[model samples]
Target: MDAVAARSGVHRTTVYRRWGDVGGLLADVLDAASDDDWQPPDTGSLEGDLAALNQEIQTAMAAQPPIMAALIAASFRSEKAADAQQRLWEDRYARCEIVVSRAVRRGDIPPRTDARRLLIAATAPLYHQLVLLRTPHDPQLPGHAARTAVLAAAAGAFAEPEPPSADDT
Candidate 1:
């Protein structure tokens, strides 16, 4: 709080009064991010769109000071921050669902595709490499992961499984 106040040129007391604590402050920051009008890239094709989105995620994960990583870690320690972070994640996933929807409309992937699963498969590689393994950045990673996911999705790997028919029981 002191550092934030100093950086923002606000008094420490004022910052404390406004946010109450670090968890509150983190939650507010995450909520503000969720309120942004950011949308996934629309590149006409599912592979292109997923590649572009992966690039964005890679850049964010590799940014200096690693604010995204910090927030993710901090969320684990604070209930408020965790809730806010989950909201932010849900908001992003919901927004990105359009990519899958667009692909379905264009006949690029099967109907009733599991958008969330496909998206996570496409984006998880970057997170695993950069955030988990802390591996050096590879320029080919974004496109490679995107291509793999697109292929899997097109093969109906992410299609929603049909429920059992009445006769099965």
Candidate 2:
């Protein structure tokens, strides 16, 4: 709090009164981020769109000072921050669902494809390498992961399971 106030040129008491604590501050920060109008890229093809999105994720995750990583770590320690982060993720996922919808419309993937699963698969490699294992950035990672996920998704890997038929019962 003190550091934030000092950095922002606000008084410590004012900052404390406004945000209450670190958790509240982090929550507000996350909430503010969620309020942005961020949309996934539409490159006319599923592979191109997924690759573009993965590239964006890689760039953000690889940024110096690693703000996204710090926010994710802090969310684990703060309920408010965790909730806010969840909301942020939900918002982002909802926005990105349009990508999957477009793919289905274009006959690139199955109709019942699970957008969230497909997106996670496409982007998880970047998070695993940069955030979890802390591996050095690989320039080819984004496109490779995106291509792999596109293949899997097109093969029905992320398709929703069909309801059991009455005859099965």
Task: Give each model a TM-score.
Answer: 0.88, 0.86
Per-residue C-alpha lDDT of model 2 across residues 44-162, encoded as one tens digit per residue: 99899988988898888777666677778878888988888889888887899999999989999998788899988988898888888988878899899999999999899999898
Q: Model 2 residue 106 lDDT?
A: 92
Clashes of 2: 0
Best model per lDDT: 1
Per-residue lDDT value at 66 in model 2: 66
The lowest-lDDT stretch of 10 consecutive residues in candidate 2 is 160-169
Top candidate on TM-score is 1
Query: Model 2, residue 40: what's the lDDT?
Result: 90
RMSD of each: 3.9, 4.0
Candidate 1 lDDT by residue in tens digits, 1-169: 6767988999999999999877788899989888888999998899999999999998888886677887778788888988888898889989999999999999999988889999999999888898789889899999999999999999999997885456842
